[model samples]
Target: MLANFHQEQSTKSTLVYLTLSIDVARELTHVHLERFLAPLQCLRRLELVIARDAKRQFLDAGQWENFITEYLPRLITFEFKFSSEWRIGQYKLDQFRSPFWLDKRWFIAYDSSRSCLFTVPYFVPTSIKHSFVPVSTNLTTLPIEQHMVFYDRVTELRLQEHLRSLPYRYNHVKTLIIDTSCTYQNIIDLSKVQSLTVDISTLSLSSLMTAIKRSMPCVNYLSLNGSYWELSYMSFTGISLEQVRVLCLSRYANYQGDNTDKWSRLFPHVERLIVSIVSKSQIPLLIDQFKNIVSGFFYIDPPYIEPHNNDPLYVDPSYIDQIHIDAYNQIQVTHEWLMEHVNRFRQSNMDNFTYQINEGDRLSLSLWIGEDDKTAQVVMNSYFKKNIVDSMRTVRSKTENLSSNTTTVITDTSTTTTSATVTTSTVTTSTSSSTSTISTITTTTTTATSTTASTTTSITTTTATTVTTTTTTSTTTTAPYCTTRVTFDDIPGQSSTSGVVPNGYKNLNWTNVLYLNSSTMPTSGYQTAVNSPPFVGYNPGGTIVQITTANGTKFAFNSVIVSSAWRDNLVWSIYGYRSGTNLVYAPFTMSVINQTKISCNACSNWDTIYFTSSGGTPRSGLTGNGTEFAFDDLCISFGY
Candidate 1:
């Protein structure tokens, strides 16, 4: 069964996390477990929940220890809950209390009544379904005794109709799924809850709103799963969930005509929406209603097709010759419909904004409302590259035309587009130089284009005209202003965890930032931000960092290469100061893995500089907004 369940023949995938919840009905053996885990050599974390098993061999810690040591050496975190039918004293628990687990602080707990042995803290489920009885006994090999708190790992909790009174505290629960009444305020900490899923079939919307207002103040992601007809009749006039930014509606709910206004009034600050619509026409109404929506996932119903009418009992003549709509055709129609509707709305309402639509399991539309200077810079570079490619293609076509003896008048002009400007003037030049000497021209003459003859003529006249030209002949040399470039590679302890940039080392006082070797600690941010061999400087926290001369000497801040540490579109701001006065300020946005050059040429003779980061979207497959940034190749000058 395990072999058939995972049919992937290749084991070359870098699978990092694996979770197995198996029942002992199939009788899992040690060989089966080894074969199942053999392909996952790169697994970093593993969680298992085995139920109703009398297999004493599965609970042997020494076997697990040896298996992990030999086969899964890359495994850093392991959690499991093995429930057996064995009696309280049937198996010895001392095998679990070993140096291998104790040194790593991986504690375990046993519930003799339930016959469950599980890892402490790590094995605690995130989402629990009602009446959770806390574990009583914890066994460990450590000398120092410590209190074990299990609810720290619980992020989502589902409650029953009747809540039980328990003397327990939960501070980390972020999601609360409730169906009916609850006395949870006394035991559970709803202050930290950000998501609330209410089964309104059993509970009243008004009562839920009252509870949200009283308890769940931080709730921003709300999911209402219940009957659509019942919810429509209920009035939500006075209730306004302004804090909700992400709203997920029940798939069973109908969102046809007037329902748009109902949901719009309820969630006014909704930026991310997950919804279900009955027809494609409702998409425009949704976009019109939710003006604040930046991105959305829409579950659209596929078009229904009529079956072939070959039976004698066919009821309606209208269904006799109906066109069949296949999945491919339906998807194409959907794509075209989205482009037509969404682009029309964007042109009228959001002219300056850009949006992208994709078709998959769900129709996703993400809009870029307002971008920072850094994001703009990245977009501009791509746009420039595209234009260059297009211009080359155009030039190639023109060259082909010239070779074919066709009269092609190509005129380059100075004009400005939306974000870029182009200026062109045709020029003709001749260069002649020797090995020992070189010639320079200060001024050059211009000429007009000669008139062309008839089209039948085989002569292909190609003229390069100069509108304005200037040349100079002089010899002057100057010393380089930027004599030193700090690359962070010369710092001692290159492979250490972290090292601070000393005051006198680079004649600068670095504050609130540290340099770390990416090779030693290959974290997500450091791996992408490292430009040099091993070292890169960064401030993990979004604090106001500073760089100042130790002896109060002034320097010119030229430029530096910077990258986002853990996010995309990260805005990094740098302010140059001289004698407590702000001289120059520059702010730019950056994406992870892309090192951007930020020029601070205007900043000169500054005694100090302040750096701060703010506002960035999380990188792909990562959680939370990262306001941290990494920087290297700082070019500064003391010549000022």
Candidate 2:
């Protein structure tokens, strides 16, 4: 009975305290072990029983000493067996036995072969000092089958004895693998684990989603079985949006029903996804269905769609001869259909787009005004075949109709007499008549007479004037000219001495500009060049110049000047090139005002500086034109 009791406890919990030999003692001891222990202490429940013959239970002196050394002093239980002929002697009793004492623990022994029993109770007077056995710190990873019972007992013991004893909580577990039988609650409790793989058949959808929401906050790699979507909708109710990074889905068949919407909600933030399916066609549709949920989805399939005829043509009906062709074909069709739907959905969102097939099996598309160029390019680039019309191209014909109806208008109006030539819908009309020709014009419904001869009579005095007026109107309408306004501001430092010149004055001169010595110049005071200079001073290091107003409030130039020589450099010095074409220079003139210093100042702010002729002799080895600098500006507007 005790053996049966031990076996039952072990099978249920698998936590063993100690073994006993006698059946009666085992029974008595197992019943009282839990009751006598401290309220918070974990009772070591027995799991196995061994009934050996008395002769086989012989113990040497050294063995006895070792046992006494380890088990004495503590009020622990022990069972011993004796031979059938042996009798309890005084020496043996004195050396090995102790009477039942409350302060010390009790020991029970049983001999199954002889049916003899012995019990040694705790005796404080006979106790010897002994070292306490240290508990192990290492934890064994339990298999999925045994985790439930193991974790329960471990947790119970931890809660009772080790909860407050440890410095930190026991949440360091990193990897968890759940098989098909684990319950939803079992997964939820393992939220601290960082990497998890779940067998899809184990949990309902609702439970799975809940687990994901709970566990995904820390998990980096998540692998799901193909049928994961089969779980209930409620299971994914509180899924976390940002936690998942890499997701792997395997052995997935075609979706059973209208599960598109549910999938979108479940994996909204999945960045990298890997899926294995029966058919390649279903891949696109599945991708489209969840495209918004994941950043990238990789579809892996067996090499079923092989090139046929060496012409880059894929084999049709890839799974026709396969064992599960029907299932594969259905999946393939669904995939292809899903992709088509996605393309349609995308195209429906575009406008004024046209698609055309190009050579080399390429597709070319154009987007008219107001259409998104980038989106069109993406759709065009993503097309696999030239003949396939992308979503953006479906409405191309609609754009054609609106574009065809457009008409260009040309209107002609004149002063002598208002003659209007209207061109609309591809037709041009010119109607001209003048009242001046008929000064005393009169009209009768049936007859008309003129005062002059028949040839000239048609042209009455007023008619003559009208004819002239009509001719003048026709000449004016044939050629029309109009003017638009143009304005120019005086470039800085180019103003006249008086600051105001007469309106009709054609020649403008600018003088008296001061050159300042400074490394950095303000950008606001000067009218800088609109672009980079035409001549870069060095192959690598280019010169940049800036002009600052007198008050240093404004500046403009091809680029910001950082060198001190910027103020002293000749305005016509070709510092750089603009657009690899036009020559650019500083608009200043350098003159030696004193023996030790020189002044470089803008010749004219109203116009760019140009040197027709430098009066000084040419520098050594330099000849011709004496560095004649010429730029287009207003101050140099007059020339001989």
> lDDT values of the candidates?
0.54, 0.28
Per-residue lDDT of model 2, residues 146-262, tens digit only: 112212111101111112232112222344455544332322345444555665464565665566675545665566663535544565556654555555565343334445456
lDDT of 1 at 347: 60
TM-score each candidate.
0.40, 0.25
Best by TM-score: 1
Clash count for each candidate, listed in order shown = 3, 48
Off-target runs (Cα >4 Å) in candidate 1 are 1-55, 58-107, 111-116, 126-129, 136-148, 179-183, 229-235, 255-257, 301-328, 331-640
Cα RMSDs of all predictions? Answer: 21.8, 41.8
Scored against the true structure, residue 538 in model 2 reaches a CA lDDT of 10
- Cα error of candidate 1 at position 449, Å: 73
lDDT of 1 by residue, 139-227 (tens): 43212212214444456788775656553456557778876666667668887788787775656666677678678778887877665
